[model samples]
Target: MASSAAPAPPAPAPPTPSASSTTLSSDGIPTLLTIPALGIKAPIVVTGTDPDGVPETPPFDRPDEVGWYGRTASPGSQGASVIWGHLDTPKQTAVFLYLRDLRPGAQIQVARDDDTEATFTVERVATYPDDSFPSDLVYNDPGYPALRLITCGGGFDRATHAYLSTVIVFARLTAIGSSANGSGTGPS
Candidate 1:
């Protein structure tokens, strides 16, 4: 004889913030991201979060591009701005492969659609298991401008087909400058 019980319900999805939940700058669309120390320069695209609240990243075919969480605060806005990249693709190292190598005090410059640049100074680098992602620290509004650069790190798991850990680079807003129609200083 079998028990006559219904299957358990699935867990609720993570919260997805509204566009108005965070302050958005007039030129919030990030056009480019450059990390001088890593010699990385890539175009940026706005990506939405999945139903589980995990940010969507660029497709494997677009390995050279980075993706910003579209619903989150803008890079220079009053919250934790997030950007992610693939560490590697099937054939080559991807856009953020060296993100974990960034040291505190390194510079990250984001050029926006309006031709202005937001500069950030790296504060810390941390690696955590994928299951132990720190949601509050990574996504909450910090009451000031901040940036988080994330990429796959640690070892690869053949069994799960995923990386064992995620590398996060936390940075603080340092300065904003005019890029003069995308011709600003810094790498192209």
Candidate 2:
């Protein structure tokens, strides 16, 4: 029988903007996240490290929202911004179930609270065990605006029934405003 469980990655590169794309000053408080390639459009929620110092995730009850690690730079800002979601929940597939499928050049859009929307382009995708997560790469400043979308993947230990790895999609700010249609990769 097929396993009924969630499975479970990192960075980016220099941004190359097309003539029609308008690059913005790296900054914004993201309120929404949209990935056309996965047909994912979800609200963004702010989350912080737990008491034990591990980064917190979105609540399981609200699987529809993506968690923005509040300690990191805001999305589209001149630093790394992290957003993550559940790959799947016991009751249903969650918002980021397909996060592992994102390929290079995929586009992600963030509607920010600043009355502006920032667009990002996927530069790379990766997966890593939860114990070996690249915290530096995900949390360190890239000296440019960057976005990291993460979800569970890798091996699932039957004993725990939890995914052992995280899938990461790293992208850099490519443009801002209405002109950034986020038209690169369509839904798979």
Quick one: best TM-score, which candidate? 1
**Residue-wise C-alpha lDDT for candidate 2, range 1-188, written one tens digit per residue:** 01221112123332333233233443456788989999988999998766555667888888889988777767766677889799877677899888888899888898887666778899999998777878778877776778988888877777777788878889988866642443432211
Write candidate 1's Cα lDDT for 1-188 as tens digits.
00111111133233334344222363467889999999999999998756654457777788889988776667876667788898887667799988889999998988888667888889999998767777678877665678989888878876666787888999987777675643333222
- Model 1: worst 10 consecutive residues (lDDT sum): 1-10
Q: Relative to the unseen true structure, what is the C-alpha lDDT of residue 56 in candidate 2, on a scale of 0 to 100?
A: 75
Tell me the lDDT of model 1 at 188: 22
Superposition TM-score, candidate 1 onto the true structure: 0.81
Residue clash pairs of candidate 1: none
